[model samples]
Target chain A: MFNRAILIGLAVLLACVVAPAQFRRGGGNAPKEGADAPDFNLKVLKTKKKKIKLSSYEGKKPVALIFGSYT
Target chain B: MQFLLVYIREAHPSDERRGRGRGRGRGPEVKQPKTFEERTEVASECVENLKLSMPAVIDNMKNTAGTAYAGFPDRLFLVDKKGKIAYAGARGPRGFSPEKLEDSIKAVLKNKGVAPRKSTKNKKSQGRGN
Candidate 1:
């Protein structure tokens, strides 16, 4: 009986964690096609440059955003 | 004219500390950075090593750009002149296709009445160009 309860508990935990990811496949929560991309300000490493915000680039040119890490 | 690379959480966070390969294939071994500075160090190393030509934005909180963009591994987005989302490419590895991004950029530029200019940098090169 204890094993059965533990198994059910683990199953519930897995579902809670993975369900959100599965539901949010590619394009999840991201701006819709044609919607304005949300603007953000992020710090640039190793420079005196000020924070960079998406709105700052408006009307100047198109912006390509690449999100990743070095691994 | 603008490209933003948001460095988020490490993809192979587990393998970051030490070089994992063998023989001539050996590489530098550094642990997964637990803080923003550590992550930035690793990121800077990668940029220098790859000679990438695009600028990068570091997501320190690991929330804003990282989680918001679903940027665990990697993703690409093209915001057009009007600031609208022109194209959204699939995620990395199997979904990672540089051609798709290049094609999308070209298409948007053409639509915006701009000329097509081939990238001088190698396709695989990854770095944050100043």
Candidate 2:
């Protein structure tokens, strides 16, 4: 029974360590400062029919991309 | 300078973070939207309730923009005219400071030799002479 307990404890510890690493990996890589911003084409929420691409504003203006949700 | 609010996945949903409560009295108690249409609907409600003046866009269901920018929860970024990331705000609820963002915008405009516009209506007219 003692051996089984040690095995279970080791398994839990391994899982704890691996879980966070997996979570961090799940977040993917973010663009670094001074690097070219990744281009995206997204639908305008106000006008659901219309779509906007980040590349369209590449040379025209300085863009502020505020990323968030209602919650 | 152009501003775009990219709506991402919910930070606190009724199902995931119920214990925290929305804080505001009877605040929106919505679940994480499952469909693109549902997500857009939630975003519309946010825009209307907040009376947000800037144009808002909805990230794809896969959250491409969110993953690329690490924008989950909330964050702000300033992209220069050359399409490079001029400023990437720290991950939010804590780092979501509009003043800091505005300061960065002003600095960028100054660097380009453009004076910041006084009127809210003139915000859309920037970067023209460049």
Regions of model 2 farther than 4 Å from truth: A1-28, B17-26, B113-130
What digit string (tens of lDDT, one per residue) describes model 2 on residues B1-130? 8999999998777767542665433567778899999999999999999999999999999999998888877788888877887766666766567887788788777877232324555433421210
Encode model 1's per-residue lDDT on B14-113: one tens digit a residue.
Answer: 4543234331134345566888778778889877886776777788755687666665567787887777777665666456667877887888777772
Angstrom error of the Cα, residue B20, model 2: value is 4.5
| Cα RMSD for candidates in order | 9.1, 9.9
Off by over 4 Å in 1: A1-27, B15-30, B113-130
Distance from true location, Cα of A54 in model 1, Å:
1.4
Model 1's chain B yields a TM-score of: 0.71
Highest lDDT: give the candidate number.
Answer: 2
Residues A1-71 of candidate 1: C-alpha lDDT, one tens digit per residue: 99999999999987897666554454455554466878789888666785788878778888888887666
